[model samples]
Target: MTTSAILMYVDVWIVLCFYGYLLKIKKRIGFQLGMNISIVMGGMAALLSGVLLITQFPFHFTVITMISTVAGLTVGAVFGLLFDYQTFVTGLTNGIIIGLMSPMIGTVIERPTMFIIFLHGFFIFSLLTIFHSIKRS
Candidate 1:
């Protein structure tokens, strides 16, 4: 298997282990904590998938990045839905924004820039989710 594929597996294991620990301490984590972790996990998965796409394609790099971004957003939306309704809205919004900007902003093969964009999306979505949750309360 490719290195990126291997890294994906490793990331999945890490997330699973971390969530398993959270499940053990769900009482302490509470809703907000769980929500934050869910966002982080979704974001990290997106970043990793972006990296994987880059590593695998390396050519037609722009298209690959865009494709990866779409894939990442799809995954994030799925995770958000699983997490909660607010997160679902946040993820979908974030994904749509990022997917639209992917072609324009990070067209080059700069991993750092791509990561930053992914992180930006993560933070924005998290903030929106939090705000919505707080408003609901």
Candidate 2:
């Protein structure tokens, strides 16, 4: 598969794992609600980013990424608080981390060395999962 396809798969896996973890912890919440909220926030971010990229707005990629990250976090946090206040912090934190890291990592791996991009995703995902698992215990 192409690098882009692999990255997309990884993104889907990350979202699924995150949603599953949230559902397991917030048993009172509906899985569909959590998934829909995540998808909506993600979609909005993508749309905004695409517009900025295509328009070649004044700001560079870094600035655009930062704006999108903040936007995603704000939206997710608001949705979380409205839906299930208990998961707001978790969702906001996860959104911020994903937002900030994803763009920076993408920029770094835009060169010929694509393995670094996969490594970046793998390491971040692994570290977060391990940290959360340990925290639960």
Best-matching candidate per lDDT: 1
What residue runs in model 2 are displaced by over 4 Å at the alpha carbon? 1-36, 39-59, 105-137
Report the C-alpha lDDT of model 1 over 1-137, residue by residue, as the tens digit.
87556755765675566546544544544455445555555555555555555555555666766675675566556645555677666665565455544444334546744565565466457546644554454
**Highest TM-score: which candidate?**
1
TM-score of predicted model 1? 0.53
> Once superposed on the true structure, which residue ranges of model 1 sit more than 4 Å away at CA?
60-83, 95-107, 110-137
TM-score, every prediction: 0.53, 0.41
Which digits, one per residue and each the tens of the lDDT, describe model 2 over residues 3-113? 444544565465456545654555544644554454444433443332333233333766767765775576557546544554466557656765665454444443423
lDDT of 2: 0.51
State the displacement of the C-alpha of residue 32, model 2, in Å, after optimal TM-score superposition: 8.3
| C-alpha root-mean-square deviation, candidate 1 | 6.9
Residue 45 lDDT in model 2? 41
Clash statistics: count for each candidate: 0, 0
